[model samples]
Target: MGSPSSLKLGVQICGVGYGWGEWRHPDVPADASISLNFYRQQAQLAEAGRLDFLFIADSLHIHEKSNPHYLNRFEPLTLLSALATVTEHIGLVATASVSYTEPFNLARQLASLDHLSGGRAGWNVVTSWLSGTADNFGKAEHPPHRVRYYMAREHLSVVKGLWDSWEDDAFVRDKPSGEFFLPSKLHRLDHNGEFFRVKGPLNIARSPQGQPVIFQGGTSVEGREFAAGHADVVFLNPESLTEAQWRYQDIKGRAACLGRNLQQVQVLANIRPVVGRTASEVEQRYQHICQFITLEDALVTLGRPFNDHDFSRYPLDEPFPDVGDLGREHLQGHSEHIKQVARDEKLTLRQTAWRFALPQREFTGTPEQLADRLEHWFQQGAADGFVINPWPGGLQHFVELVIPELQRRGLFRREYSGHTLRDHLQLSTPINRYAPRRELI
Candidate 1:
C-alpha cells in the first residue's frame, strides 16, 4: 500500500458566488462566471502549468437575501460538462450536493462527463449546508444534520452501485449477429432504503474513474467519517501545518479501519496566494485589493460563512463582539480560520470579531514567498497538495506571477500528462466492478 502523503499537487477553483472582488480586477476578464471561453482559457492555463485538475465548488441553493456581488453565475456540473469539449487533459471537478440531486440522474451525468472527457471527471460530493436550498426543494427548513447525513450515506451507496452496473466486457460489440450489449454483463441494483428506492443498472455505463473521483468537505464529526469511508479526496480548510498533519493521518487511519485503501485518497486544504516580485510589493498589492472591497459586503458574506453575526449596521473599524466560543456546529468548518485570524492579526474582542475583515485579501506575497509557502505547506504536511482556492478575478495574476515561480522551483508540472482529466490525476480507467478485471495477470 502506498502512503497517502505520496499524492502530488492538485488545484481546485471555486465560484462560491462571484468568488471575490478580483472579478473586477484589471486582469480579470469579465463574465468568466458564465463564459465558456473564460472557463476554457483558465483550464488551458492549469493544463499548461501541469496542475493535476480544475475543480469548481458549487452550492445547491442561493441565499434569499444575497447581495449583488454574491449572486449571478452558471451551474458547475453543466459548465464543466460543456468544458469537456474544449480542454483536453485538465481534470474537470464539479460540486454536486447529495442532499438535492438524485443518484440516477447524477450517475448518468457524471458517467457521461467521464465518457465525454475520456475519463477526467470528478464529483465533489457534498451534504450542503443551506436551509434556503431546502426551501427551494419544497421544504420549510433544512432537515436536521443527522437526518441529511443519513440520506447522504444511502445516496452515495446507490451512486456507487449504479456506477458499477456494467461489467467491463458488458459491451461486446458483436457485428455478425448485430447484438451491441450483453444483458448478463449488467448488475441490477434494486436498492430500497430509508431515504430512496433506486432500481437496477444505471442509464449510462461505468465512468472512466470508476466513480468520478469522489471529493468531499465538511470537517464536522459526520464529515470526517464519510470522507474516511468513501471520499477519494478531502478538500479541507485547516489553518496550520499542525492541524493539517493531524487531519491527514487521522483520516488515513480511519480509512484503514474501514478496510479501504488509504493511499488513493488525498487531503487538499485551501490555499490562496497573491504573487508579486517582492514581499513588500506583494503586501502592497494585497492592500490594494483589500481597499476596494466594501466592508458591508464582506460583513454580509462573512455573516453566512463565518460568525453568522448580523454586521449590517456595525462599523467596519469599530470594536465588535468576539467569537471566542464558536465551534464547527456554529460556524460550519470555519472555526479554525476564525481563530487563526485572531492570532495572526493580534485582535481584541472587538477587533477579532471580523473574519478576514482586515480589509485585506488573504493571499499576498512575492513569487518567492508564495513558492516558499507552497514548499512549506507540502513539506510540513499541511496538505499532500493544495487546491488553489484563489479569490475570483485573481487567476491571471497567479498564472502570470506565482505559476512561473512554482515551475522554477520544480513544485508544479511544466506540461500536461494526458488527454483526459482522469489521466492527469493518475487515476486508472475504472473497470466495471460489475465485471472482473478482464486482462490476464
Candidate 2:
C-alpha cells in the first residue's frame, strides 16, 4: 500500500471574486458578496470537509472593463483575518503580488494571519505581469519579466528573513521582569537588494506555522524556476491524465536539474466540476449553466483564454486579424493542445475557445466518480491534489456530497489530523535560522 503520509491533497477556493457565472447562480445567496457571514459559512463548511487549506486569490489593481464582474469582492488578507476566527484546520492562502507589496508589510500580514489561524496561513506570490495594474501603481508599464523575477527573488529573500526575525521562543511574556518579549531573540534584517531596501524586524513574532506556507503557481519557464527554488506548493493546468503526468514529470525534472528536492513541493491543477447522480442529469445541469452564457459573452470569452488576449474588445461578429509578421511563430505553449482538442471534439473556433475558457481540469461525473477520478490522478502522479473552483451555491454540494465519498473510501481524512493547515496538509513547519541546534535546547 502507498504510504498515506505521501498522499497530499488541498483545495483552493475563489473568494466572492470572479468566478465566471458564480454570482448569478440561483443557489448562491443573493447577498453573498455583501455579507462577511456568507464567507464565514463557507469557511466553516471547508473545515467540516477536512480540507488541507482554502486559497484566496487577489490582484493589486482592478481591470477596466471586467471590474464590474469581479472587483466587488473583499481583499484577501483582511477577509482571511476574519475567517481565521471561524475555521480550525484549513490554511488561509492569499495571493499578494511581489511586484506591488512591501516585503516587510506583506510578511507581517501573512504572519499575523498565521497566528490568528493558529498556524494555518499561506502566501501565493505573484509577479503581476499586468501593465494595467502597474500603471495604477504609478509606473508607466509593467516591469519586464526578467526584472520582475529578479525583484521577486530579492523580495522573497527579504520576506523570509523578516519571517525569521524572531525565534519561535522569542516571546517571553513573563510578568516578573515586565519584559513582554525577549530582546535577545530578535534579529533585524537589514535587507538591501537591487530592487528593494527593507530594514526590518517584523513587529509580529514568529508565525504559528513557522512561516505561512509559500504557495505559487506560474507555468512559464521563469515561473517554474521560481517555484522550484521557493514555493511549497506549485499549481498547474492539466487537461488530461497524459497532460498531468507529463507536466508532473517536467516539473520534477526541472527541480532535479536545479538540485532541489522534488518532494518538497506540491503541484495542484485547477478544476471546475459539474456533477450529478446520473449522466443525463449532469448534462442537463451543465446545459442550464450554459444558458447563462450569452452568444456574445461566449464569443467574447473565447478570445481571452488565460487572460492572454481580450477578444471581448473586438466585436464578436467581426473577422480576426492575420498579421504579416506574426504568421506561426507566435503560438503559445498550449496551442497544439488547443488544436488537438478542437479537432477531437469537432468544435468550431468560437466553441473550442469558450469551452476551454477557464483553465480547468475536467471531471464530470457523480460524487463517487469524482472521487475515483481524483484518486486515479493522485496515483498516476498527474498531480499531488486539486484546487476546486466552486460556482457559488454549489460549494455546499462539495461538502455535502463529494467530501463524504472521499472520506468513506479513505481517500481523504474523516477529521483533521491536527490543528493548523500545514499539519492537516502534512507539510513541514519551516525552522528558524539561528535557532539553538543542540540535541536538547
Candidate 3:
C-alpha cells in the first residue's frame, strides 16, 4: 500500500476541550459549547490554517451521565448551515443518524446544505449508538447492532436515490418559451426496502457535488463492509501505529475487493495532539491538562461505549469484571476493544477507565516532534490524513505551531485548490442517474 503525497487535515470544532475535566480549565469557558461566537472563532481559525474541513459530531440522546460537551451543544446541520455563511473554502461535515430520521428529510437537508455552502457539504452517516436514544425516537427497543447496519444500508440507498430527483441541466428558465424545467428531466425515487420506503423526487435541485460526500465511521465487521461499499471517506481511531496501519490496509483492501477505486476511499485517523514550545513546556502542559481528569468523571465517560454500563458497580481496585457479551448490542466495536485491552493488560476497573480518559501520549510533544510523528504516519500508510480533536487551547497551539512546520515540509496544503469538499478530497463528481441518454443520429 502507498500513501498520498500530501496530508489532509480536518479539525473537530467544539466549544470545550475533549476531556471530562477540560471545562474546569482556566482558559476554557464553561458555556463555550452553546456559544455561537466561540464556534465561529474555531471555524475561522481552521479555515485560516488551510485545513480541509470542520467536523461537527452529534448524538440525539443524553442523560446526566453524558459528557459535558454532549450534554449541551449545537445541532450539527443547523450549526454548519450558520457557519457556511461566515467561511469559504472549508468543508462542513455534520454527523447525522439514519436509524431515526426519514430518508426524504435527511436527503433534502444535506442537499440544501450543499447548496447553501456552494457545495462544501458532507454527511457523516451514523447509526445512533446510545441505547437510551430509542426513547427519544419513540421506538420500543433499540435495534440490535446487526439490524442497525442493515437499516443504514437501506436508508443510504433511499437518500442517494432522492438526491438524483433532478438532472443537472433540467432547469432552463426561458422567458420566450415560459419554460421553467423540462418535465422529462424530473424523476421520482419509488423506493421500498426491508427497513424504509421513501418515494421521492427530492424537492430541491441536485447540489454542486451531485450528492454531498458520504462519510462513515465503522469499525465492526458489518460496519467495515458498509463503509467500504458506500462511504467516500472513513473516520477511525486506532491507538497504535501498528493498529492504524492494519486498519488502513483492511479498509483499502476491502474497497479494492469491491471494485472501488482505492484513491476515492479516504481513511482519516482521529488525533489529539498536545503541543508546546519546549520539552519542559510540553511536560508542563501535559501535566496541567492531566490534573483536570477526576476519577469519577472518567468512570462515567468510560461507560459510554458499553451502552452506559455502570462501571461504578464494579470494585474500583479489583480486576476488570467480565460481563460476558455486555456491550454486544451497543457500540460493539468500541466496547469490545475496551474489554480486550482490559484483559490483555490485567488492569483494574479504575485503571481501565483512566486509560481511556486521557489522550494517548504518542501525539503529545513539542511542535517539531508532533510534526515528525504526523509525517511518519502519513508516509507509512497508517493514514491518508488526520482529524484533529477539539481541544480549544490545543487546537490554537497546533494551528499556530504545527501547521507551519508541516507546510514547510511540503506535507500539507498551504491553500485550498477548489471550492467543494470533493475538490479538497480529490473525489470525482458523480454523474446524474436521470440525465437523458445521447444518441448518434
The numbered model that scores best in lDDT is: 3
Best by TM-score: 3
Predictions ranked by TM-score, top down? Answer: 3, 2, 1
Q: Please give, for residues 211-323, the per-residue lDDT of candidate 3 as tens digits.
A: 99999988988888999999999998999999999999999999999999998999999998889999998888888888898899899888888888888988999999998
Backbone clashes, candidate 1: 6
The residue pairs that clash in candidate 3, if any, are none
- Taking every candidate in turn, the Cα RMSD to the unseen true structure, in Å, is 3.8, 3.8, 2.0
| Model 2 lDDT per residue over 1-441, tens place | 123534455555554434445456676665566568888888788777777778777665555445233457778899899988877777788989988888888998898888898998889998875456776788776776667778889999999999998998888898988988878788998987788898888898887678888887766567778888888888886778998898888787777888876767788877777777777866776776665555454444443233334544544333332222221121223434455565677765556646665424368778888888988898888888888776544567677788878777777777666777667666677888858553247
- lDDT (Cα, tens digit) per residue for candidate 1, span 1-441: 112233354566544324345566665556556667777777777666666788887665555456333366768778888888887777788888888888999888888888888888888888776556777788776666667778888998898889898876578789998989998778889999988899968878765556688888867777888888888778776656677888877787888999986556677877666666776777777776676456555565566654345656555564444555444433355655665665667654345544454433434677776667767877876676777766554565677777788777766666664565555555555566545544442
Poorest 10 consecutive residues by lDDT, candidate 1: 1-10
Better of 1 and 3 by lDDT: 3
**Each model's TM-score?**
0.86, 0.88, 0.97
Q: Specify the poorest-scoring 10-residue window by lDDT in model 2.
A: 323-332
Candidate 3 global Cα RMSD: 2.0
Error of 1 at 125 (Å): 0.9
Off by over 4 Å in 2: 1-7, 15-19, 67-69, 299-308, 312-348, 358-361, 436-441
